[model samples]
Target: MTVASAVPRLLIVAVSARRQDRRARLSQEIAGMIERLGGAFLKAGQLLATRVDLVGAELAAALGRLHDDVKPMSTRQALLTVTTAFETVPAGIEAAVWTPPVASGSIACVYRACHDGTDVALKVRRPDVARRFAADIAIVAFLTRAAAKLPMLRRVPLVEIADQVGMSLAAQLDFSREVEHLRRLRTDLADLPDIVVPAVLDELSSGGVIAMEYVHGLDRAAADKLPAETKEAGLSRLVGAVYHMLFVDGFIHVDLHQGNVYFRADGTVVILDAGFMFRLSDMARTRFTQFFAGMIRGDGEFCADILLSTVRHVEKGADVSAFRRDVTDLVARSTGAVAKDFELAAFSVELFDLQRRNRLFAESEFVFPLLCLLSLEGAVRRLHPLMDFQLEAAPHVMHGLLLTDAAVT
Candidate 1:
């Protein structure tokens, strides 16, 4: 069914599922609908899965299934798209040898192949995905514009949010951008011994295709079966690498979904899929690092002030002082808490809810970093539940501060 028709049905589902138990069923229905839509809608569902605050934890968990569970296109269609990606097919690789897609998502399908004795993975963009996504985005933008006219939605900046989501989705359509992101991540994390970013085969890659070294690491479930020490070590490397990206390099892989991360028996981590990445400006990076630093030191006032600095526009008559006080209290209470004790998801929900209640909307730049951490928390919790998040972040926070000071001097 078209989204236009689906909307009214979705509204009826929402109204009927007022009870908590029914909401879980509603979440599943919504996710199934998104999967059927299968373009920008799938991407949107994956993103919404990160915001446990905006969507309740149950719905967010339901939507999170969209990350890796979508059905794949047929082998025939996948092969055709790969062949069309290049003017001349690369030597030693033919349709007969190409295996059915080992992994699939809304935008692309990945097939495993061997070229010149080297195993490589071919990521081919789905046929007509760009046009489909564009059409879907246009529809969303139109709906958002119409919704913004209502008094309740007037304060939400729905049009701007829709535009940003559209641009981000559009960027993922260009495989060359993912190639660039993978290369940069490889360089940035080169110092970390246990982390792996697969090498891209530049000669075989194009706008619609990515040919990269085929990594054969275990998925999250398989990795969980490994020894406890191995899991902890691999997870530590993963967390540290993320810290380096956020605080040191300021370039982050925002999509840390289960499908994108893998682990090996030797405690090595393999990170894949760089299509959804974000970079922070130097100012934004410094401000966020400073905020974390303040949180570490239990200085709620400092953290509150840092958050205020990142606000794009404050609502008229907003109670700025009260907002500051509440933020400060939150930081104080959360100080020194370990991952098991302090859930970033819960903390973020409360923090964002406070901002919404106080009408203090921070810039997306600042919010994105927190979301990155929230996304990472899933893997972190599964791998190392007892980790002291604040304690672990101290060193990287210090390094970030040092970098900021050096820049000023």
Candidate 2:
């Protein structure tokens, strides 16, 4: 069935599953439907998997399988795509030596190969994937616009969110831009020795194909079984690197799903797939930093003010005072809580709930950073449960705030 037809079925299923007990089964059913649809729908599932605040933890976990479990193109199909993209087979790489894909996703499948005596990972875009995504995005835009007409969703900025998703999907189609993202991230995280961003082979890469250094490392589950000290230090480095990206540099890798993050035996973190990324404006970055700084200090009013300043729209006759009070109370309750005690997913869900209740809509750009953090929180908690998130973020927040103040001066 087409997306337009499938959406109504989805809505019907949602309506039928109103009872709390059926939500888990409902989530699985919806995930299965999306998986069968494939293409942009599968990509959307992968993103929703990270958004526990919006969909709840159970549903998010159900959809998370879309990250790397999609069916891959056949070996011949994959080879043909690479050959077509290059106009001919690139030298030093033979088709016969190419093994089956090591990983597969909505847009591409990754194969392991050797180039110039160095092991490399070859990422080839699926045939007609771009055209399919374009068609799906158009349909999604129409659906979102229609959904926005409902009274309950009028303040949600559905159309804008759809546009952002479309832009990100389109960017991912261009392998060349991902190359730039990989290089920039490598430079940005250079100060952190434990972080690894693989090197891209420009000569072998193109708009549709990317060749990069092949990295072998343990997945999150395997890494969790490592020594306690090693795991702790690695988790610290990973979180610190993420903080550096958010606070020190405005650029961020928005997709930090389980499939993209790996850990070496020695505790080095390997970040793969630079397809989905965004750069925050200086103002947004500073505001985000200030907000976190306030959270660290247990200053609820300050945090509320920071949030208010970044809102894109405030509904007429909205209760701004009540919103402020709610935010204040939320921060107070979360004060001094560690990763184990304070769930970012739960906190974000409450915060977004408050925004919806108050008809306060934050700028999408500002909100995406929080979503990125939410995406990483699962790994953070799994690796180091007792981690003091606010405390860890304090230094980066202070540095970001100071840098912004100096720039103003």
The numbered model that scores best in TM-score is 2
Best by lDDT: 2
Ten consecutive residues with minimal summed lDDT in candidate 2?
91-100
**Cα lDDT tens digits for candidate 2, 1-409:** 5656777777777778767757887788778788777778887688677556567888977887778767787777776777776766676444522666778788898877777677788888888788888988888889899998998788777788779878887888888889999999989988788899888888888757888888886464556587988878877888888888899898988888877887777879888899888889898899889888889999999999998998977878888999999999999999889777887868877887788789897666766787688787866666687899889988888888888989999
lDDT of each: 0.80, 0.81
TM-score of each: 0.85, 0.86
Task: Write the residue-wise lDDT of candidate 1 on 17-127 in tens digits.
Answer: 767657877888888888888888887687677555557778877887677667777766666776777788886445623556777788888777778888888888887
Give residue 147's lDDT in candidate 2 (0 to 100). Answer: 96
Q: After superposition, how far is residue 345 of candidate 1 from its true place, in Å?
A: 3.1
What value of lDDT does candidate 2 attain over all alpha carbons? 0.81
